[model samples]
Target: MTTTIIPNLQNFYNQSQQKQDNHFCDCTLQWRRGQLLVKPSGQVKQPYLPSLHNQPLLVECLKHSPVNLVSIDPKLGESSLRFWADACEQAHKPIFLRIPPGNKLPKQSSQSLRWLQRLIDWMIALVLLLIISPVMLILVMLIQSDSPESLFSCEWHVGQRGKLFRAIKFCTTKKYKLTPLGSWMCKYGVDNLPQLFNVLRGEMGLLGSRCWTLEDAVQLSLKEQRQLNNLPGITASWEVETQPKLLHLDSSTL
Candidate 1:
């Protein structure tokens, strides 16, 4: 089967092949039509599953195959972005997608306007914190009363221009564990209230693309990484548009 390999990843394939390390780049890429492309580094141990016979081969391949990760070709269309994103989340694998050349970039606001917006974000976050202090205190008390553990969670996220920052949230999940109160906090995003401090500290904004975790961000193509040129935000279009579909997919998988 003919698999078009992107030139940039050719070296990675070569290195993986030389090292014979399945741990490094062992994956099957779904190329044009129903063909499967194994990373040249090493052969994928799983038998080939043809997509022409069974659609959703990407997800199925990952679900059943022994391969540790998978990559999707960008030509699969915009909908594939949503599809693969959900698929990768389910597989808990690193995702890689090539953004087509000359893709229109998000317009960067002028420096002065950016400063003004930052000023506004700081002000709003401060006011929100003040207004919600009592509610936040109550949530904290409820959380402590329910779980009796650390009150916050700090995760590293990639911010504007690839700066790493610790994003703070209520410790709603404790490494495969969650309490009833923690689940409620997560469901309503009350767990995220601590991020107001991130905004106040100029590490985040009121609205923009949700900052991708460092693990995910580094895997993105340079063009896709352009989305990070702007500050990370509390919420973004992905929530309203992309996330509900993912939730549905997640539910269907269960």
Candidate 2:
């Protein structure tokens, strides 16, 4: 079976691999014909699943072999994004469709939850800094003695949404001047300590999406826009989930 990738769903039928579904049909007729196409807007189109089957059969197929995400543009107004979201839930699929009120965004669970999380992060980072202060101080001295550079440095990173922030870190050398201490700091993640201030200042969430760069975000695929759908965390989901999935998919596809 082959899947067609057309920016315009209305043209799916006309560019058929074979004439079996060459006739144009509206979404209503296509759904009635037990064919499912992951499209947001289309007046006339071919249903990807337009086999001689009923709704129940189509539902079963969807449940078994479903596409995980389909982002629909809310501006299209061809179909209710909510309706498709519900249908996807019933079929155990997930649609990243845009909802109404374009300005609406994903929010923290609650004000209390946000404050509590922040308090917890503050306490944890503070306590850790207190305990490790002596060691960090010694490391700073050693780093200064070993290298002719500052013990700390700041790098710019894209925070939540597209805001830029200076992420301070304890470092063994200045920019572009690597030292032996830098290697050890990298191995142990000790250089990441100053970002505790970022977590405290609410520039980033403790657990959210991955930190990105302004250039990196600009270069992302339209399909990858969902990565920015949520607030970026100091440690992010992309570092875990998307990275591994892409690796496996690339190897298998090759």
Candidate 3:
């Protein structure tokens, strides 16, 4: 009996082999045939009364097997079975598939409120910064006591239309030789208050793509740079949302 396995299936098997013994059974087996063929010596038992869905067959097979996770790739062109498999896979259930059609592009919303909402958020942030400047001064003085260096760190950030400006914040790292208080403010994002000045000055907006450093901005692909065409740069998104995750994934891939 000859069976053909997808290259991804082989990779999954190799990855599974490196797992701990107690976790060794989490294998996703993918087959490209109409029906699954089990080895008589294989200890994993098939689930009784399995669904006919082919998309998630691998997942279902894994459930029935001693393993906690499994995936199957079956013969393509069977739409009904493929739909069931896709649904099962989405639910994190076991299923099989033969690589269905590519996903459709998502539609953009037509509501005109997005711009107005961004403007309102910017105004609120600006007002809050003005009301808090006095307190910020006091904090700056306190930071200066901890480190007798610069109380604020000025970082060059890229904003909308590829404009560059200095973004002021409290320093967080002792290695930077800035005021210790600046470092404290940076650690908690308290130093980001001054960026409200940038917002009011039209160099930034409240809810938009994050501003990048010149070095980082150059790394953006042409397609990614297009996202900047309509919006001002932001202070927080890259640090808070995107960079850490991307770095982790890149390291893992390497």
Candidate 4:
């Protein structure tokens, strides 16, 4: 694979939360024969030759690789970004789309701190689940009686560092018609209760930026995309206080 040195966009998170000094985060990206390859910084480079076979090959060569994060060169085109974005999302790795020089890299916490935060998230979700078990059980029965559809609805949403995950919520509506019980549940935001499972799964937190669907995520401006650096929250200021007018309104609501 053709390898070249590029200025790494290291440890970027949302500005309001994290900060990191200038330091090389050991990561590598390779482009050869129209395919992308990611490797560790310390690995010895191997000679790459274009394959002679005519059969198609999967572009994701590192699907099982242990790379923690992947960074894309700012100069790469949209196709490359989309390919890596989907790949990284599947591998559950954060992706960094390098910004141009002179722009401040967003602040980020250390890896340990992030892990600590995740542990806390798990604890909080567990406690909440226990405390609300009775209410959730009653809601489940009501939802079953209200609609023939499944009890939960899940849709693809962008998570921290642009990773994509299915955000789960209670199925409050069927065919766009909110059930009588669903209307009451939504009015009190109880429809969001199922998302605590997403928190336990590490796909969301108790408080952070709103979770955006992939369609809306792709339409985001470069500056707005930075919000993906933070985990989507079960309850966030953006949902009620200061919403993004650009998002598809119907999709934002349960």
Candidate 5:
């Protein structure tokens, strides 16, 4: 029955209210000891919990949780919500006890446009791949002429919904050394050209949140991870474009 709360919850809640004009809402859970209580905020008293037989209530509860956008910690298994409840309790935030209406949720920016954009991106990628394949082959030969080994490199990346997929690119380095070519490719983003295949396959999009490796994703703050709820991974974003400036500033500050 130990309650651990996140001290930042109040600040986040207050900020949300100011930015959203009090439109920010979530399901409220109130529990003490072994008793579990659930309800939606801003609603009249109703028995939404203990009604596990009601599929709608369950869905509503999930839909309304403020932390829905945050990726669940795998180690928590199904008890993640319980942990959130404990955190809320420790923070001394008023425990809400009714599930919000399921239908009153905001739409994601990428889902509706995905299918239409997929075909267009695929056609563009196919054209690029055809044009680039020969050049890529030549580059591979050039690199191998210097040193013989694997021609391509694959790195696991995090995509939308926190899915992991392999991102492939031409090897720009020797076996042991990440070559100058690799660094150049990364600097100009030439290394990302092969990711067209991922876009064509619907594993990613032409424009959306930039994908990261699992380690990078895990390092992100809760607020940062919430951005992933909208779309699959992409080749670039504001974060990538401004990374250099950000790094410089961070270094100076440090």
Candidate 6:
């Protein structure tokens, strides 16, 4: 496994909506894989995913991964700013005042808060999955009929707290080759629907940060790493914010 850091793009909910329930909505980090992909969005070499011989190996792999904490941007709100300052003072690691603070709870709140979040995510994922299943089936049949070799595929994405997970999505294209099936998948974003399962499994949220790829996350800075503290999401601030800018990042600077 390679050493990688999380990106810190923290910010908080608006000042008026301070309830713990609502704060997570904006604490989300920004992610944009299609935009930053070294190649057009398609099957990346399977080499990108970690190989594990056993369950313990998997746990050890994650344990070894450098942690990237989720943080709220100081520029976003006051509470976020205070929390970021506090963490900086306590950790005393870096001095990037040129400052932070999430879903990683303005620090880890009570069980009740956890329960509420789980329930909401579960309900929404269930509903969306149900509504999309038929269309999904049709799409799958079309994809398989069009190119039987590319019916299914898994994308390795960096999830909550920077753990790597395989997100299921349509194959879209044959290995190293683009087909008509791949074209539409990218055009309509239908390829992302399966992420709802990621949501139901508690690995992601519907409205959280843009899902991060391990390739992209590895390029993040200590300051940017704070972004991982929040739960990874399917739709995020990226939709509203400008495109993410990690394509040209130089890891040595960090």
- State every prediction's TM-score relative to the real structure: 0.53, 0.47, 0.44, 0.57, 0.50, 0.52
lDDT tens string, model 1, 48-164? 323312336656656665545444443433343345555555555544443333334545666678788899999999999999999999988987877676888786565665455
For all candidates in order, the CA lDDT equals 0.59, 0.52, 0.48, 0.61, 0.50, 0.50
Which regions of candidate 4 are displaced past 4 Å?
1-109, 241-254
RMSD per candidate (Å) reads 12.4, 16.8, 18.9, 12.0, 14.4, 17.9
**Model 6 lDDT vs. the true structure?**
0.50
Clashing pairs in 4: 18-107, 18-108, 19-107, 19-108
Q: 1-254, model 6: which lDDT tens digit per residue?
A: 22112233244223234333333212322223311111111221112222112334434433444323223232333333333333333333121221123233443467678668878999989998899899999998998888888676775555666544567777766655556666566555667778788888887887777666544554567678667656777776234211222211222223
Candidate order by TM-score, decreasing, is 4, 1, 6, 5, 2, 3
The reply for model 1, stretches above 4 Å from the true place, is 1-109, 237-254
Residue 2 in candidate 2, Cα distance off native in Å:
46
What's the number of clashes in each of the models?
Answer: 0, 1, 21, 4, 7, 16
Regions more than 4 Å wrong, model 2: 1-109, 172-175, 237-254
User: Per lDDT, what order, best first?
Assistant: 4, 1, 2, 6, 5, 3
Point to the candidate with the largest lDDT.
4
lDDT of 3 by residue, 1-84 (tens): 434323322222233223323311222323333434221113332222223334366455435544332233222223333343
Task: TM-score for candidate 2, please give it.
Answer: 0.47
Residues 1-254 of candidate 2: C-alpha lDDT, one tens digit per residue: 33333234443453223333333222322221233334433444544444222345544555765354444343333233334444555676544433222236437677577678778877877777788888878877887888756777765454543344556677644455446676566545666666777876777666877775433544555566456555567566235434443344344434
In candidate 2, position 19 carries an lDDT of 39
Clashing pairs in 1: none
Candidate 6 stretches with Cα past 4 Å from truth are 1-111, 237-254
lDDT of 4 by residue, 1-254 (tens): 46532225353333223222323222345654543444333444333211101112212434544455665543344444555566556555666544323235445666677688889989989999999999999888888888868899886666776665767778877776666676666656777788898899898998788887655666666777777777888887236522333122335454
